[model samples]
Target: MHEKHKSHQVSGAHKWLKRSVAHKMFDRVPVVPDNFTIGETNDFLKTHIHEFETINYIYITDDTKKLKGILSVKDLFRKNPDVPVLLQAHQDLVVIYPETEQREAASLALRHNIKAVPVVDHEGKFLGAVTGDQILEILNREFREDVLRKAGIRRSHMMMDNILEIPLWTGIVHRLPWLLVGLGGGIVAAGLIARFEEILATNLILAAFIPLIVYIADAVGTQLEAFVIRDFSISRKLNFGKYFLKQFILVGTIGLILGGLIATVTNVLYPDSRIAFIIGIAVLGAVLSSLLTGLLIPFLFRNLRLDPANASGPIATILQDILSILIYFAIASRLLS
Candidate 1:
């Protein structure tokens, strides 16, 4: 198999890779905001612990630069340093950016053996801090969410039932744009049906199978889109060759199997072998196109820095339905003519 073709396959680790590492990994950058600061080591320690609650370190910063000083409970209350401990007293302060990858951040933290690192902006001003515990928690939560997403399961139940607890309104807030896009997709599908009015009028069976064909294609597209979005989101680097090959193989196999089954079933049930074969071929072609659409559409949206899932979901399925109809009719015309 061509290396590029491996990405589309449903076998082995490909699906798992798409589901696990790609879907659920930490991506959000820790930020303390420009206004973040610890006034003085001792005073800040007293107040910050009360605010953030058992915080690891007090970040010392000013309007321009992050002064290198951090005071933990142990440093402040336990064996205090023999010198005066001020905001800029300590010479070492580790800082990270908001856009740093989670894995890389974790690795850095581990290397230094530090519990917490302050986050700073480009100008060296402290934004906030990320603790070792927080990083691990975020990664674990993301892992669960990713697994659930791949299974077509809601994540609310997995970690804390937040998915279950959050009202549908929350999802609606995110899904509203996609839902509108779905409406537009419906319009496009309707247009395709209208264009094929003559064919549907002559063969009612064609109309009967159209919905099923479109729905299956849409489902496949949704699954592929989810996987691709997760991959792009977690790892800014596009592992294009691998994903492409996997999707192609998996989608192609599904198309072949479905097409063959439809052809066989229709030939057995209906009186006309001619219509059955044509419909089978058309359905198969539509399905394959749908899968490809699902894979590519989200990838493109992500490339453009858009929310791939929200932007691609309704549009991909709608376009797939339109394409399916067109392909189905084109094949039908050639065979029936």
Candidate 2:
């Protein structure tokens, strides 16, 4: 009989794992109708509190089973016994729908700093509560998924599955798509450089700064991409216009400082004021353009329902390189000519 019960329990857990929070996995903790007075609730809790997995908060509902408020156990014990539960209950409730994804429900709880989240039906009827223990499990699972995704691993693998156990061909298949796209971007970058061949030939010294411009711009872009990826993962409602304006101003200031340093150094070394001036302006433009590209591309990807991290790697690098080259040579051509 014990073995049979254990088998049933395992099957129930597996079924819950594959289903939503409404699937009887959540805790149906103590609930009191809002009409109950403090005295009545106190008597009810004394008898029934032990039945719940957690008695931190008691859900308050109306006759129709609609969620009305919540009362902390601490407040319940301290309040006047004759006071109505409604007077002492916290009416500003944070609730989740039963159909909500378990991970999303967990995220909401974490965001609001709530110990447990109440589940409600479409009509706002109380269902149950997703307790803190279940939330911990959901958060752990999501953390593993996020780490694997950032490492470019496939989601088909289980969180506890050993990476070394995966077949080499399966790993290759998961990684090959991005690599091919990166190869194509490299080809495009090569084409862009070839188009600027005349500027390179006329001012051979300009070729010397190509790697410098690309490297600095790539570095700045990578930093911005990292910030965007972290921020967007937590909150999707970022104000893009305000964010873009702030980044532009910040990058512009950095560009001016960098440009001045380059100008001072090149003016002393080159002995040609015109060439030094052109290089300084080109540096400023390249850096600003790279910063904007980095800030905007991630937002664009996010809007298109693609992972912004995809903007962080080869795609961002190649774009910054190509744009930096174009901006540098354009300034050089106008000033040096």
Candidate 3:
């Protein structure tokens, strides 16, 4: 990341490696010559430890700074320190380009258990290292951003999807089905809520949780929608049956944990086991059902030759809300009536 390393930039001055986040994230590493003996490397390290930003691995390079190998601190002070450092350092290494995406770099670091990913130029010259601490921060930040983006808020670029390029009538046709379906679904939802009017009056507390149940279901559906859309962009032939079966298991487990925790907490706070049981059971049902709507709507749109993201994103969110309400009230009425 320093000015001196700028000379090693690949393909003139405008290469991806020089411009990507990998360039900014890398830190100055402790480097040694490939021909140096272990004893000499140790002496150099003792004197220059403070000069390095990350010392997780000692990089071995040639006079031209072409990375040759690497060794841990333990390997540097092994029983025989007189041999050339390359004799002990690992040569077959996992590395990334300065142009590599931050998430990808973090993945490589985790997959190899290397703690850090070494950044190298096209010519195999070392640039620097993306350290362990940096990797963790990158992953954690991505996770939070992903959760917020998929559930809490959504950001979309219709231009990227070329929605404007399509003919107006055709676009309308693509979107119209969901709008009409949502209109009908909305009417059904309102009628259903009205049908539950007596249940609500009998236990007014039941009304307070309508938004929470709807949000929990919609949030889960939105996350799956975002993830599946992204996955399709990356690999179009991704197996949905595999994804479908896997979600049942994963979402089922999540439902059990969340349901039981809420049940336990509600019973303790409200001292009403029946309300707790009803709320917990309703939550589990909503979550499991949301998973189905999340996956199904996207595929349904794709089958109809429309953009799946368009359907699952904004147009069909009402589907999950409707489903959640149906599940919640159906369970509540059965138990209470």
Candidate achieving the largest TM-score: 2
Give stretches of model 2 more than 4 Å off. Answer: 1-27, 37-53, 74-82, 98-107, 133-148, 154-161, 197-212, 226-243, 250-295, 301-312
**Candidate 2 per-residue lDDT over residues 1-337, each given as its tens digit:** 0011222011233444354666424444778888899999999888876567678788898988899999988889999999999889999988876556676677678888888889887899876788888888877876676565545555565356555987888767766765676678778777877877887788788778778888878877777777777677666588888888888898888888888898889889888787788778888888898765677877888899876765666556767888888888778777766
Model 1 regions more than 4 Å off: 1-97, 101-180
Candidate 3 residue-wise lDDT at 105: 75
Q: Which candidate would rank higher by lDDT, 1 or 3? A: 3
Q: How many backbone clashes does candidate 2 have?
A: 0
lDDT of model 1, residue 296: 72
Writing each residue's lDDT as its tens digit, candidate 3 over 1-337 gives: 1122333222232455432545445445678888889888888888877666677889898989888998988767663878889888899988877777676677677767887778888999887788888888777865654543333133331122356687787666544654676687788888889999999998888888888888887888877777765565444467879988887788888788878888888899888999999989988999898776777777776678654555564345777888889999999999998
Which is better, 1 or 2, measured by lDDT?
2
Error of 1 at 122 (Å): 12
Error of 3 at 278 (Å): 12
What overall lDDT, based on C-alpha atoms, would model 3 receive against the true structure?
Answer: 0.73
Which residue segments of model 3 deviate by more than 4 Å? 1-19, 46-51, 62-68, 110-113, 121-125, 136-140, 143-192, 195-241, 252-285, 292-319, 326-337
TM-score of predicted structure 1: 0.54
